[model samples]
Target: MNTPSAGTRWIQLGLGLIVMMTISSPQYVWTLFVKPFQATTGSGLPAVQVTFTLLIVLQTFFSPAQGWLIERFSAKGMIALGAALSGAGWAAASQIDSLYGLYATYGVLCGLGTGIVYVGIIGLMVRWFPERRGFAAGVVAAGYGMGAIATTFPISDMIAASGYRHALLVFGAILGVVGFIAALGLRPPQLGETPEIPADKVASAARDVPPKTMLKTPLFWLMFAMMAMMSTGGLMVVAQFAAFSKEFGVADALVFGFAALPFALTFDRVTNGLTRPFFGWVSDNVGRENTMAFAFALEACAIALLLAFRENAYAFALLSGVVFFAWGEIFSLFPSTLTDTFGTKHATTNYGFLYMAQGVGSLLGGPFAAMIHDAAGSWVPVFCIAIGLDLVTAALAWFVLKPARRAYLGVPVPAVPALAEPLAAKPLAA
Candidate 1:
């Protein structure tokens, strides 16, 4: 098999970015739809919110199977199928009259669709840029993180102008078509294709560890727990921000001449997008665990500040962006670290198992967080729980994840040299 030129790989990256961006609004812009759905269905907040949890759970829990399918089939075809499902899910959702219908359409269909494109593209990016795994992954992850920024206000306006149903139908078709067209152009790098990197920058793993072998490793499970914990904190904010903002009487307040909720949401999206690449680049040079520790700790602090001053609109908006900026890098850091540790041969499948942690996080972060707020009659306990989880995860990233990964790979602290080192030149075991 022939390896494509750098230019060709970059083009593939661009297409993956487009596909990711198109599908991302479904997740990120979901908060905007929550109130509308609840009003339309007359379901309480917790019941309406369960759809969000269902979406994430299905999207994440089925990723390993989705990854396996992508690996065994045409990447383009699988992505196209996913795009169709995602778009159709939204379109179908616009006509649903009940929560169960919403779950079937938006939760199950869109979840499965996004899962397929997400894992397939990440795997493709990892394969295409073996030497720049973090950056490549970050670039694509940014599309998912920030994609909704372009549409959030538009959807909000459409909901206000026409209705949620109309907004869903129009955007669903556009995103689906765009995603499908872009997916049609995606091609995974040929097997055994490797990018050239400096000898000192090779990853620690000497050979690809099959997914089965990776599943049994303590390193993988520890990383899974870490990912879940980090995910819970971030996702809690993502799914519940609008609710909290409303409860605090700041949702409609003005921040810098813009509505506080939309302004904060847009700002959060930008910071969220920027953090993926920024931290991914940082991880490439400084080390993944170090970057994780820094970003996670920053998130913990931001959450605490938000809880302290949340009633103030300006503080709420600013701190929300900070919280997201600190949180979003997990999307980039985890995948790069996983591929770095386990090898890229089975990256799509291996990351699938790890990605399930996001589903677990969603269960904890989405519905559970909402339930906590309801039970306590305040967002205070929710914020406190999130803060504690963030701090604990940050500590574990450095103290536990770092040392365990080093021992698993038999490398020293700060394992930068091994990633770019020539595969055949190293004596490390698979």
Candidate 2:
């Protein structure tokens, strides 16, 4: 296969973004459907919420197999199949009357579909933009993080007007079609080829490290632990935001003339999307561990404040956005960092293992957190656990991840090259 030009690679990136955006709403807009599903099915909160856990678990845990499939099959074909499954999942759920039906359709099918699109796109981005893995991954990840902003209110309104069934059918078809078309446009970078970069550009890794080798590294496991910790907190919020908002007595309150819940969800999506690229760019310049520590610490603070002042409508909205902003960077940070450390030869499959941390996180954050709230009669203990995880993860990023990566790289810490530096004839292996 011929190498794609920079322009062509960027166009592919744009297509990946659209694919990601279309598939994102299933995960992000789920909270909006919780109450409606509960009312319709007459299920308890815990039983109804298990679908969310199932959604995240299958989405993440199956990613490695999905990633391996992408490597062995046609990227376009796999993505098309994924899109179809994702759309059909939601559309089929509209007809289901039982929780098991939901688990079969929305939980299983949507999870598998989203996982395929996510892994495929992230893999494509790192290959196309090895010189700026963080930024490239961030741009696509932003699509997933921010995609729901455009649909949250619309879904809410639809659920209110036509009921959740109609909303699911309409949006599911739209997402499936759009995602299918976009997936057709995606192409992987040529094997054994790297994008040309300036000689002075900061190289992420000296050479490619196979997935097996990467798994053997202690650094990978440490990063995994940190990612799981971070994911637990953010996902707890994502899965339970609506419940907590109502619990705090601010779900119906107004913020800036808009209902607080939707307003916060929208605002959180924006900050969530923005932080990926913002911190990705920062990491490309400042270093990964430094960025991780900063973002995680910010999340720790935000979650604490959110718990403390959640009853206040304004504080609830603002602090929720802050928490997401800090937390969402993990999507960009961990993937880029993994590729940076392990190299991109098996990025899709390698990152798949790491992505399972999110599955672990979903288990901890979703049903487990909900169970905690039920037992405690408060969200306070859950929030405290998240805060503690954040602070500990932040510390590990600096003290553990930083030194570990350097030792693995066998180099002293080095500064990123300035943009003014001349372009190199050969590209970096990362």
Number of the top-ranking candidate, with lDDT as the measure:
1
Backbone clashes (count) for model 2: 1
Candidate with the greatest TM-score versus the true structure: 1
lDDT by residue for model 1 (280-383), tens: 88787767887888889999999999999989999999999999999988888999889988887889988888899988888789778989888999989988
**Candidate 2 at residue 298, lDDT?**
97
- Per-model C-alpha RMSD: 3.4, 3.8
Q: Give the TM-score of candidate 1.
A: 0.89
Regions more than 4 Å wrong, model 1: 1-6, 31-47, 158-163, 191-194, 246-249, 374-377, 413-426
The alpha-carbon deviation from the true structure for residue 129 of candidate 2, after best TM-score superposition, in angstroms, is 0.9
lDDT of each: 0.86, 0.85
| Candidate 2 to native Cα RMSD, angstroms | 3.8
Q: Would you estimate the TM-scores of all the predictions?
A: 0.89, 0.89
